[model samples]
Target: MFFKLRKPIFLLLSIPAIALVYIFLRNLSGYSINYQVSSPCACYKCLTDSDPWFNYNISENEFNWWKRLQTESRSFGVYGTTVANFFKIFPRNPDVIQPKPDHCRTCAVVGNSGNLRRSHYGPLIDLHEVVIRMNTGITRGFEKDVGNKTTHRVMYPESAVAVDDNTHFVPFPFKIQDFEWLINASTTGFTGRSYMPVKSKIKTNKDLVMVVNPAFMKYVHEVWLGNKGRYPSTGFMALILALHICDEVNVFGYGADSDGNRSHYWEILTNKGLRTGVHPGSYEYNIIQQLDQQQKIKFYEGLTKKM
Candidate 1:
């Protein structure tokens, strides 16, 4: 009995020593245990995968669920082949690099709500390390309200826009044809018919193109939005994407404008009845509000006009 009690006590005492040695080694390897424990955003658990790049190992169930989110009718085999071809041409590099403990990366997810019209948020928006704009969001002629700096642009074929060589031209591919369009658009120019007319060849640096993972998209839909609407909107996708890549996120130009209109800030509105169409706009906005309430993100509603 004496021997057993002594042995157990000795083993228990060794635990702290072992832990100290492990922590010392981790420090020597430039990994921070404290930062790992303390630095995650409030919704870090919801945001999985440090790298949201395409992989061939996506399961059939995931594919089926994600494909159903869009109106695409391509078979699983065709999707797989297209992804394979895409990787062959484009390097499967991680879009956002692993964050260091010393770095506090801030991001801005700028939407195209008309509320940003005279907000004068340019200087503030440009301060972020990463500025992610989406879907035909132009920075010209409105640089005072919307900053000229665009580090990443989230788009699909229908909402494609031109970005400088420095910007990461991220395509939120909804179908196999979208992948095909990216490949052909960069090389020989796309000629295939899509649901909407897409530019045959967009003037963007092919090397800077990044495709959003279908699995990540599915995660944003099911986990974040609780699978609401037909699928997640590009604005919502960019906001969630910011959560993973940024230590702190500041959102701007979502929801209705100062006049309570849902039109783009860049265009004049004739259709007052226009809504987000297929996306669950109100539900997504609620999620954003929840995140803001939880201090996970800073949502800037912009300036409200006075009567």
Candidate 2:
């Protein structure tokens, strides 16, 4: 019966549906996507081992071999040889040697999930110096994911808002809004898009918000992501923050189940079909496994799924 009068009913529903879509689009809109970047065509020579400070301590023969490998790796189909070169950016403080904490910090990267409403992670999240979140609208029923202990909220303008003194806003420089944040960040770090809005918003002497340069993203991809050179989405971003800032980083509520199937441990609408993470593509499950092996991070794998 609904289909018998299909065209008329379809036209009737379209008006409200169109209005709803417009509202959704406004909410979703943010930085202009960079389309110029194609796949890495040649070795990114800028981030290379040939530089004067290319670890001169290693023997000439070993260094030569390493250089050869770097080039050959690219020729044969390898990427990311420059990941270790970040020390050049911020040379490690040899004076303050030990970075790994005696006890690993349990920092959670909370996802947007209504299921966390009563999960009770406020105090736990507060303990972490940083709690990375994405895709705002969090101040709602999901108390845990958008914990009261929100130390850092990293997003575009649509997501930025009044956080407490400790709550720092780290917005990825994508469009005009980012330009505004950059102006305000005492200091900022950029991976690529440096002309972000944050630059425009600076008025005082607040340090720049640390930016993970696009070059760094490429480096991270090479170091962690396989030769194809694709980067882990925001998951890698969180890991990179831990790698740079904290001695220990604890991950929570990530990954599909043990079956390696795509399913949200978080709740979903009954009418909707299953939706996978918009994060890094591929066996990030495998990548996370490697990160665990290296003791780089600890995943709070749900009790439902285990080793």
Candidate 3:
């Protein structure tokens, strides 16, 4: 009787185990099983080969090459003089301040999606060693959702916001005037004018101001994005930047919300017709999804399943 009972029990337990194996194999069939962590550094050669989406560090020669290309394309403005003058003031790239130490750095790229409102990702996001936020995504009232800590804030001149003293204000300059704007804003509070008016005086640590290289932007557009849309959006640029600086990257609050609308988590949108204009939203989404699937980056899609 003991021998008979043992066989029956073994069969029963083996059923679930066999079923689990089948399920696992089924899911694993099409997926790439090799899980490799991405490197934290970036360079020109690596950008083209391993990951085209990667943003590499730019040299002064590369910067000059890009500017010359832009000049030949007739898209270049008086950027040469403006950038030279601007560098004379600030001189060095602020990214040099935070050198990559001999340790793994986990970074979180936090986007502003309404799905994050109730996801309770604040605690998880704050756990990262480096948290990069973009634009006007504030943490004052939305601390419970977006977290209160910000290590780096990426913004263009138009979307500039006030950051804490400790946070790095990384400016994504699109044109010559944008570079000039940073120098003036840092020192004289903008005595010069441009095509459009920008914030003359920004309240933040001047030393922590890092300007994104225009050459980097060009690389992102032509190489990474394949000149997909009008231009690479701020979020996409920030994502690439994080990949270059952080060993492990976890992306949050990206993609369409639960209702499938492109809206921000911090604001209310009554218009459903509003879409991400001038951006290749669909193409970019597919690329991000591919990155997640490839294990190059970990993407947290903040949506709850309906039971």
Candidate 1 lDDT score at position 122: 89
What's the count of clashing pairs in each model shown? 0, 33, 0
* Per-residue error (Å), model 2, residue 258: 9.8
Per-residue lDDT value at 58 in model 3: 37
Descending-lDDT candidate ranking: 1, 3, 2
Give one digit per residue, the lDDT tens place, for model 3 in 1-307: 0000000000000111111000111221122223224533331111111212222333355455545432323233355455556656552444432323345667899988777878888989999888999998888788878898899999977788888889888887665556667777777787665555678877777667666665556555554566787677889888877755666788988878778888888899798777878777777777777877766678888872222
Instruction: Mark the regions of model 2 whose C-alpha exceeds 4 Å error after superposition.
Output: 1-107, 113-121, 137-140, 144-146, 157-162, 174-208, 227-230, 257-279, 303-307
Q: What C-alpha lDDT values do all the predictions have? A: 0.70, 0.37, 0.62
TM-score of 2: 0.48
Residues 1-307, candidate 2, lDDT per residue (tens digit)? 0001001100000111111000011111111111113321131111111111111121233223333422332210111213222222322221111222133333556544333344466556657756776535354455554455565555554344444454544444332223323433423532333322323232221222232332333333434454343344555555554444444466654554444444433545453334444445445556655656655466555432344
Prediction 2 global C-alpha lDDT: 0.37
Compose the digit string of candidate 1's lDDT tens values, residues 1-307: 0000010000000111111000011111111111234544443422222222222355577668778766678888888777767766665654464565556678899999988988899889999889999989998899999999999988999889878889988888777788889889888999999777999988787677767766566656655566688788999988867865677789999988777779788899898888987789989988787777766578998864444
Candidates 1 and 3 compared: the better one by TM-score is 1
